[model samples]
Target: MKVNWFRRQHPLQNGDQLRCHALAKSPIPAHCLELFQKSYPAPNSPLSELKCVVLDFETSGLDPKQDEILSVGMVDIHYPVMSLASAQHYYVQSEQVIHSKTAVINHIVPETLIGGISRHQLIERLVVSLSGKVVIAHGAEIEKHFLRHLLQLDASLPLPLIFLDTLRLERSLMKYRGVMYPDLRLTHVRQQKGLPPYLAHNAFADVVATGELFLALVEEICADKPPLLGPLVLRSL
Candidate 1:
């Protein structure tokens, strides 16, 4: 009797299912586990003083629990120049074959990331790189979900770093306005506001777009008052 390799209990693809099973069976490194459990800053922790890291991730699939992250990109935003020199992008090498459809969407092929670092190493590097910074992501739920799974993989994983969703900020900015665009897509919003075009599916490009959108929304929200970053809340209609 032969067992079907693809007919596993989980819906995970072959490579991901194999990696998940392996991680579950083996003891994860104690030090690596410790880093995951590290703590982050709180809301009252002085936003002005805190560094903001804009992040974006392109993954093979949507499920953070099952799908693998193919690439991670981030840019450090500290006002002044908004320099690209502070950006970081990592591609993860995976044994999993890239689905043709997904590849068409994300434009990341296995061959493209062949000599890149591993997922575990990428996570470790990201953790260290993002330390002592507030994380900003456009439509942050996906990123948060991914981070949650990463933390859960190691029990000692700390809570997520401070997070600000640019999607939420954009939504808040449009709340009081009478005219509303039919589509709230990021690209649509950028174009409507006369902002630069972003090549979708590229993590670095998305991060830069999110950063610009965040700044634009902030300016709109802080029109009457001295510019300050705070909890951006949507006013009820």
Candidate 2:
């Protein structure tokens, strides 16, 4: 689960893609298999030609191994454009008690989560939505870790994911600009980018903020020429 964030990674080569393709024939759920059957974008594909989902997760804690996800929110984005109509948010029901400190931050209480959907249902819907799309997140590690743990795909199987992380990209840009230290928090970055702030902590609001920040960053990253998916991709899971 420890991934290198200092440098951008390239898209997976054909061998990894072939492994994922082979996994599609394994005894997995139909929804996941459907996603696997869809081809990942070619490495040289233009950024605008790719489909992406901006996602955020609210959890009991940072450790996916020990923590439980409380809610998930996502919006579809095609480079500079984000689709509000495609936004989806879901609260997850769990056996864990919601601590007061965590509740204060995420604004979710035990009573609220009581009406949330089961994790299995949430993941199923998510898998269907994620078919053939990359995922965008401010800090992608949290989402990637939680998702991998939830899917419980065999460790031997290639995850076959490309997670584009705004936080990491922003940090790299700052470093290139000679700034030794920078604030990469979601709301702070949005503010720096002149994006209007939304109420924080809510999963849906955070996803929207991340989506906007992503578009702004893309504008900066591709200012000279249209970039390919390989460069914009920050990490693969």
Candidate 3:
């Protein structure tokens, strides 16, 4: 993502300069900038060296503004080292309605929210895990909008997020390769790639499935060259 690396001898720099230089290029929010100011990783860090986190959310509806996120699930992968055992799942408590249509998709019973964490607390935990990591999701927009809406409650909330969307990535790769598929749904793409089928709608299962799919697809895009996460995001664009 940094082109000047080849121009100079790569002058030695401090961490703040590296993070600020990268943050300046991207439209990161002020809240995010504050949280990552002291610890943001180098923007040019290669994918093989970055910490990756795959995220999935089961929501009451598709609209982030209208509906609510019922649960969140995520797994961490440090390139060649995947930490499946370090996965985290959280169910959010809400006073809002959960229609039967929503239940059918997410399988989240209203009873599950009896002692679930408050939306406030859930976002707190989420941001902590997401800090200084490359977050990934199957359909990035949903996650993006939801987090923005939830975390924008006040100036104290930091919703610094950009996800590598496997769904978008698959579409780009297919177009680049001159291949067409019936659909871009998670299950459909997984099937086309010879990946195992997974039960849809469970937050944990969806993220686990997405992580595997991303690893498989990235192999094609990177080929023999070492992949840089920032550049890969651009390739999808």
Candidate 4:
């Protein structure tokens, strides 16, 4: 899941309208289909208690107008237990050409994505999947900007449910000592905390990695104060 972060791209212009049209495509990959089938909520779990969805996205390049989203990945965190059963991932067909550096890393060649779903379908599915859950991304700015672009594109589309940044949480945990790096990249935090290794460039892998880091940071924060997901997210602001 090696991804080339250096070649990432943005998905919209500053004032572009978000639009959608149905486009047919081949069935989702068998593995993805299986994962989606098993990724539903537990029968008795209250939707209100779902809390947040750990999200990560890989894009074609960094400029919204010139770039496109290559894939989006998320994990619905309900607390107490974490597993692949709660994960979701989607590969999209981008109109933008995949940059050479990006292709080498994510391995998402243009030909391989020939029959993938359109941006509209992908965004609709993402919004539906994330309907009531907060979104937690490694670098909040990138995800936030992307979401804002989506809103500008489609004024009718609702803004994100709620948002949090694991990057900020990690920074707060080390406030006294100062961060070793000016930018708190997810890989750096994972390494410093001795959490699981990051599968760079893979959307789902990054989501899982960030989720683990978030849990660890919550534990550390809880040691000095009570733990509540909402408060932790707020403390970062």
Candidate 5:
């Protein structure tokens, strides 16, 4: 009963089924349709067979409605193998001024974005990269929220997507051990797991940090071999 209620509160996707149903609806964007056309992995698929895109975004502020994205970093993990050679980083041009506090946190300023790409262009590249692959993020809600808003999709129809949320997976493990209020922050969690610290708050470095942490968590959870995909991925919305 508890698990059922919790799942209701935080919904999980049925992957391809959801995609088929959503695709049947009218007024979906071409990019979104293009994304959904690719089949997601079956629930029984091994994690080792999955191609995961670990991504991070530095935003001007937390509110997706009001604030803007400053930069994005992403790296591909052909599960159980990660290579820095696949990493891509892009600073985003925004009309808003970079506040001092935001700059202090992410070290990105207006000057840094002078040569940056437009938000639409970045999303186009991101959509192409994300096709048929699962997304992994430290705190995936930030990315999910930002992407949904940027895509201008109707809030009524959520994206038919699955995210491997490192933050949620960590919290789920801690809860199973009866530990509440665990330090689930990206840096703290990495430290606790003995992951070597990377330069904090920079988008590229942070994506690398997130990807490493995901690998560590998966190893800890399934030591014998790769686990099935169903138990690990979730729908953030």
Candidate 6:
């Protein structure tokens, strides 16, 4: 029989809060979802022991207040290992539409960009995927701000997320070693560490790069066996 690597071993999670998929469209207050906290690994758990969801977003613009989250891409991580079995990509439905300038970077053509799910629906799906996992991203603050801003707009979009940022980690390591550069783009950073080049812009691909970069960083930080995850967390900016 084949194995389902990403399958949730515990179909009945202990004290798991209401399933995001089962919830109605109506908004739920943050306090109401407190019991579901355990769905994700504890903030202090070992990085190698926690399951993570690598995340990347392509937006209509850079500013969260003005720009829209054009797309979201993610892949699940089994602790220190990466897996593509559970990868996902979704383009958000919007009235603003994709601009030519941004399109050049994200490679989401006009035709393929059509037919998107509502933000609420996307959040529902994201919540279900992320309920019990850590989040990995190149620059986590971007995703965090955008998601939090969306949550503020729609309370039902609640997700308690902890992020592992590859770019930030690399920069810190470089700085500690007294290195500096003009740019620290994802592909650039990955190449600096001898990782093979990959096409940029696509959210899924970016997440994959970020995931791989994270593993490489862990190899450096942990050496053989790193301590608990609490110490590695990057504080909210």
Candidate 6 on 195-235: residue-level lDDT in tens? Answer: 99987888878888888888888787667876455545642
lDDT of 2 by residue, 23-50 (tens): 7555654545665666677678888888
Candidate 2 colliding pairs: none
Ranking of candidates on lDDT, top first: 5, 2, 3, 6, 1, 4
Q: Number of clashing residue pairs in every model?
A: 5, 0, 0, 11, 0, 1
Clashing pairs in 1: 36-157, 36-158, 37-156, 37-157, 37-158
* Residue 226, candidate 3: alpha-carbon lDDT: 80
Off by over 4 Å in 4: 1-50, 153-158, 180-183, 224-226
Q: What digit string (tens of lDDT, one per residue) describes model 3 on residues 1-237?
A: 344653342221233444455556555555445445535444466888778899988898888778998999989998856688989988999888889888887888889778888986886777778876778898888888788787663433334444688988888888777877637899988998899889888989998999998888888778887877656666544
lDDT of each: 0.67, 0.80, 0.75, 0.64, 0.83, 0.70
Candidate 5 structure quality by residue, lDDT tens digits, 54-98: 988999999999999999999999888888999999999999989
Candidate 1 residue-pair clash tally? 5
Better of 1 and 2 by TM-score: 2
As a TM-score, model 4 comes out at: 0.71
Which candidate, 1 or 5, would have the higher TM-score against the true structure? 5
Runs of candidate 5 with Cα error greater than 4 angstroms are 1-13, 234-237
| TM-scores of all predicted structures | 0.75, 0.88, 0.80, 0.71, 0.91, 0.78
Instruction: State the lDDT at 12 in candidate 2.
Output: 47
The per-residue C-alpha lDDT of model 4 at residue 81 equals: 44
- Give the candidate number with the greatest lDDT: 5
The residue-level lDDT of candidate 1 at 140 comes to 81
Q: In model 2, which range of ten residues has the least summed lDDT?
A: 1-10
